[model samples]
Target chain A: MSSITSSKKHPLFWVLLLIITVVTLFPIYWISVTSLKSPVEVISSRPTMLPQAPTLENYVSVVKSGFFRNMFNSLLVAVSATLLSLTLSTLASYALVRHNFPYRGNSLFLVWVLVVKILPPVVLAIPLYSVFIKMGLLNSRLGLIFVYQVYTLPYCIWMIFGFLKALPETFEEAAMIDGAGRFYILTRIVLPLARTGIIATSIFSVIAAWDEFLFALLFIRTPSLQTLPLVIVNYIGEYETLWGELMGIGLLTTLPVLFFSSYVYKYYTQGFSVSLK
Target chain B: MTQNKYQKSCFFYLILLPAVLVMLWLTIYPVLNVFTLSFFKYNYLSDEKVFVGLGNYIKLLKENLFMEAFRNTLVFSVLATAGEVILGIALALLFYGHFRGKKSFMIIAIFPMMVSSMVICAVWKTLYHYDIGLINFLLRETGAQPVGWLIDQSKALFSVVIIDVWQWTPFAFIMMQAAMGSIPEEIFEAAQIDGASYMKTVFSITMPILSDQIMLLIMLRTIDTFKLFGKVYALTQGGPGNSTETLSYYIYREGFSYFNLGKASTASIFVLLVVAGISFIYIGKILKKD
Candidate 1:
């Protein structure tokens, strides 16, 4: 439609794009290199752009210090929380979209859920701590899995509810006309259709639970129960700088999240756009 | 069809019952407990639960550290939220058209957002180290004196803000980009055919269409940044002095570190009110839009 502007692309645009790309990736690149550097090269007076002598010594030591166990702990908590939230919220979101309630509208329920979701995790920590202690849930992975529903459940409900709302009522009505019950219609029709939203919700829940630090730090006093974030922060508190090992574990911890995010990048963006709608 | 509406209601409620109960116990109960705790001079360590009836609130409001933390949270959130949304929009605009390597570039840009805050801070903390740090190394090479990135209290909050911007700008960018991408290319083409310049097109056409997503992004980032804890915990630990103290960090210290449950509860209530107020404004805007 336009020839004049399209005819000549400015060099400055390319320059800016190049700068943006580099600035975007430099820290990740630097951390990756730092993680691979030998101990001598790590604390050297001069910064090394590339590792002088690369070594796995840092990763080895990090693993030796219950790092894998911590990673496993994070995995257990995040997966459990995601699964639990998704299961409950899927059923709840379905009922929310398809049926009418006696007292309040479904949208109001969503608002209530969003409000709870937004409460700062720190505010919940002290009370939850005392409760968990009485319930014998402190320093336990199961406790974190349960408590993390505070974030994950509300998110799943709101997000999946958005997805369910956008689906046509005709298909479900047709199923009902055939004498299909609500449970059968939901499992066969709604769940299959909302798979993308379900996947996106799962990814979001896992990320929230994985990145959670304040609650884990407060509730899980047992070192063995510490999650990856806890272990990384423990590196800061217990030892010297140890930037090499720190970066090594840091890089490892981030890889799974990066891959998962990139996988659901499309749905993640779509979910945001849908929520705004 | 013969089944009563009551049974239908029961079925729906039964399905929702588990999540509702869990959320109620987790959210409402804890919140009310925190509210009740705010009125007492409770210390978990000493097992003291003397009723103070707003004494904790008075004490916290009068505490210098609490005031500093509140101010720091406001400054950090305002700056960080503004920087992220603005820069995010700019970046989204810059990459408006099809370009080489655009897909990979988008992914790379958001990598920081996907990574943990503590990890990012760990990397940045090393970079901000006084000596033998990459930033200082770069400064010395350019014959410029190395700046105290974290050590100097005055610059510390700004440093943390920069990190927040770096880590979160992609979030705003992605949301904006997704919104911008939805507008038909024909709209932009029509604007171009009408002899509109790039700046004119962006301000008049692009931004107006993307404003809803922009509002959403601002609300999300503002609430998230106001609850600043992981970065402070990882990087500054509320700092060389009270320089980097945030409301969340302040609450953490009072509740966990000091075990002064009443002061922490009071501080938590303050944070809750402020956050709820900000969210209330945002939700009202959303409801109006809908």
Candidate 2:
């Protein structure tokens, strides 16, 4: 009786695990499979579970449709914004962590940062539209990069602040005693120790900017300047969707993020854990 | 020495000044600008601006489309957050102990969350297609009638919610699993030795210990789901008669599509108040912990 019960429980566990694994991953599998199918097979009444004659035609066509230009736009904006936000946030968070400001300024600043993080992006976008127009930043890559700071800056500050707070002050204090200047100590001692956190924060920031759509849609008018997401949406037109090409662009756009995310999977999970605390 | 100390403080502020200035321009000034814009009759295209104190707000309140959008946003937020958190706890429990292929399985499990949401939505959009979709194809295989997943008004919002739950459950699971790892194994071992059933141990021992983490997860997911725009825009475009229209999407259409900055600003203010109320509760809890 005991053996039978144990045997019954084991298979149930495996079955449940298999169910979840399939449910969680099936869309990704379907996307890849659909992307490989020819346009005729993609929209057929009887959808092929596997492309009978798998081809790279969808990818070719999508690329021919100026996919690379959009991808380049996305890459440029994401990278530039990530670098800018990371630099600003690292300096600010370091100051917040290491120095005392008057009137409980550190805590007040942190509270404000948290509010900015929580506020919906659309709230800011409404006003920012006019602001950008006045500044002549409309329809420019530089404008998009600057606007993205609204999302990335507060996040980088908080994540980096957590990491800086966790580091022991002894190392920095000793460096100060040795007459090392503050900038020298910061460059030599603090940054290296917080390298993991900084890398993790930057990767997440890049992903956020890369995926940003609402701002890009509103700001960029020129077909040449639009980002990957805008192009992906264009594939799903009001009249007809180019499913094969849509999936092709979708998979292509995701590959870079997937590669980077897997590389930092450990830190990604750790970042969430840190945020929880 | 005091002069040197003062100089060092000045250096700190100097390094911090740039971020402070950008944030002030980006967040503070825009927020105030949005508030002032909400009171006007403004149109970007024609460059018309007239002060209509609270007229935009009153119009939005009476607008059925706006009301429907509000209701849909509430429903979507509640359902998506609840689904993600619950499924997350279950996944965490299922994968609690060590097993063969655990690392690979965990990595695969989290892949959905890492991918761009647009890509995820595009994939699901194909799968949710009424006639040609894989989901409908399967239903026919089992001799079940096909359901309109995204096209049906009753099912559109729920379809969007399912995609959100699919993508984000891993996030909640990762968080829950991390918190679970912190629990000493000895406690579970003690419970087992005391003849506690698995269900009993989970409910009594594990849950009480995990309540705080669970609360934090709910707040985080709530704040995120409240800002649901990209998914709706990509999938339904809040279609099939406004079933999936969210506040963010509503604002996007009003502000961008119609160029009605006045209406958009008013809707944005409504979203801001609700979000502020929610975040205040969350911040209050997080601050108390500190």
TM agreement with the true structure for every prediction: 0.96, 0.96
Question: Which candidate achieves the best DockQ against the true structure?
Answer: 1
DockQ (C-alpha based) per candidate is 0.56, 0.54
lDDT of 1 at B261: 93
Kindly list the per-residue Cα lDDT of model 2 for residues A1-277, writing each as its tens digit: 1121122336667888899999988888888998899888988988887999999999999889899999999999999999999999999999999899999988888888898889889888977888899999999999999999998999898889888888999999999999999999888999999998898888888988998988998899999999998887777654255788888888899888778644555654554434621
The prediction achieving the highest lDDT against the true structure is 2
A1-277, model 1: which lDDT tens digit per residue? 1222252446887888789888888899888999999877888879899998889999999889888888999999999999999999998988887788766767677778877767788988888889989999988999999988988888888888878888999998899889888789989998999897787778878988899888888788888899988888887766656989999999999988899656655654554544421
Against the true structure, what is every candidate's RMSD? Answer: 2.1, 2.4
Residue A107 displacement (Å), model 2? 1.7
lDDT of residue A244 for candidate 2: 83
Judged by DockQ cut-offs, is candidate 1 incorrect, acceptable, medium or high? medium
Which regions in candidate 2 have their CA more than 4 angstroms from the true location? A1-9, A261-264, A268-272
Docking class of 2: medium
Candidate 1 lDDT over residue span B44-75, tens digit each: 88998999998988888899999999999999
